[model samples]
Target: MKKNKKNFETKFWAGFEAGNPFEASDALFDFAHLDYYKRNLTQAVIYSFKEEICSNNTPSEIFIFYKAIGSFLKIYYSLHKKSSKWKVKEPVRTEDVFHLTSLTKEEYDNPFTVFQKAFAETAFKDFEFFLAEIINLSLSPCKEDWNIDLMSPYIHLIKMLDAGELMRERGLEKIKK
Candidate 1:
């Protein structure tokens, strides 16, 4: 059982690295179904996001990664609220994983800055919706209702926007050449 669980987790990370959202999402759904202590689940989410941001990926890939993170968070938060058995006194904050410093005007024009802006604008909205849905779904009698897929039309919109941003960046580079 343990070996199978490890293999399942390996599939998730492998899919994540390859930017395959469907594979990662399916693996994550299976992994989340396994019995987990609250601390371990929270740690999984924190570490997953930390690793994602640290790695170099395209903007659309990052969007997909964020969706996966948001999906995981939905499960984590639902479990946390629905159970009174465990309490996390000091939950891992996002700032702890994502180190953000002030940037100059010149720095603001960079690709990273564009990603930061998109994250603030789009990803944050997705997280907010997921959180709201989680809260609403918690009252349901069915556990299956707790599983919320983050992939939607909104995600496609963000992907299209990211692609447009990438094209604009490439155009700027070509002009500079």
Candidate 2:
């Protein structure tokens, strides 16, 4: 309801014009609302999730992730109320955020739900930003946007599931030589 602490909308647009939307510190995590992102990133994110879970998780593991995903969506949706001061490129409705992955904000995911398992065991913050970036790609207003595919965010994300794993993989690699 109140103005965002920072004028992130202006900053995001400015950053986009300057190149590197994700590189900016001021962009809000406002991707779910973009129509372009919904069409494009949805499948990419789905693929990335499947790739991540294959090694260590049962097909059934995603069932547990749904609960967490639903909770975060509710928080995301509420932040963009009609009265909010943030600028909007495209107006969003409650239905705009819908997906097979999202049955309801308060509803629980079925055990076998694809998204539930991937999301359940995953870190919420990365997933949130990851989704936001996906949305940004989908909603890019013009040409010359970042080459990020909806699926690519998950590649990094899968690796991000565990801090120790990331630290060891990159941290050790960087330190190795």
Candidate 3:
């Protein structure tokens, strides 16, 4: 099993290096043993790679990196779900995070649906908005309930994004020096 896993990883990288993203993605999905939820996540990565990485006409190396990441996220989410052991924890309500004075129907519904179509549809043009919506879904003030355990992956995503944003800002500041 370990050897098979290693070979799967090697084949994936080899396909990616050979400038065959479709092959790489197929190898990943086959070796991944993905469930319904994870398959959707994989679809998102593929869509992002095709739309953002390919249409932008990035270098092969950059494209491969993003491709790998999409696969990685799918794997990570699957493993994370498994490790959770299906423990039942009380969900933290939205009121615990924010005191909303009022909200329109759209405002109330948006948070719940932000991610519903993210993987299913490729219509979301604003990548930043899509990313922000993902993070916001993890954070409250926009939801009626939260499950810290189930939402762990999203919370970690937000932390990584925040750290990346800080590094980007600092890099820009240094560039101006």
Candidate 4:
């Protein structure tokens, strides 16, 4: 059983590296298979956000953070708009997710301050629940049986988010020199 599991994982990674979504999806029909993908992908995105975006003190740091997170929310909500349990009346826009425009100049300047304000708001709470639902759905043991396709969008979004983070890192380096 362990050897078979390893074989599946090996195939999954090969499919992933080869950019063959169908192959990858095929290899992820089991709970352990899907969980492995979910854990690694989620960690990568969260780790990158915490280390790269959260730690940055640049003037546009807050904007970058919002853009990344808001992109996730926008994509998640858009994909699940009709069927999502967390029914958002309006579309999730990156700019509107944090209500950053309403912030005072002082709050705008400090990314931490902006985060504090946003974190305390209802929007953030909704976002938290929405995120939790995504995580839970992704890890569902019977996810492969579900008619609704969820993983593909998440996989695409993860790649896009990673690319955006790489670009942001390059831009930040340029700003420093």
Predictions in order: lDDT: 0.35, 0.32, 0.32, 0.34
Segments in model 4 whose C-alpha atoms lie over 4 Å from true places: 1-133, 138-144, 172-177
Count of backbone clashes, every candidate in sequence:
0, 8, 0, 0
After superposing candidate 2 on the true structure, give the runs of residues whose Cα lies further than 4 Å from its correct spot: 1-4, 7-10, 14-34, 46-101, 105-124, 128-177
Residue range 65-173, candidate 4, lDDT tens digits = 3333443344323322222222112222334324223334453332223333333442434654444444444333332233543344444444333322222222211
What TM-score does each of the candidates earn? 0.22, 0.24, 0.24, 0.25
- Arrange candidates by TM-score, highest first: which order? 4, 3, 2, 1
Error of 2 at 36 (Å): 2.3
lDDT of 2: 0.32
User: Model 1, residue 11: what's the lDDT?
Assistant: 29
Give the total clashing residue pairs for model 2.
8
Considering every candidate listed, which one attains the maximal lDDT? 1
Supply candidate 4's per-residue lDDT for 78: 30
What TM-score does model 3 achieve against the real structure?
0.24
How would you order the candidates by lDDT, starting with the best? 1, 4, 3, 2
Candidate 3: C-alpha lDDT: 0.32
Q: Write the per-residue lDDT of candidate 1 for residues 1-102, one digit (tens) a residue.
A: 333211113323335332222334345544443222122323323333332322323434334444444544433333223223322222233233221122
Provide the lowest-lDDT 10-residue window in model 3.
168-177
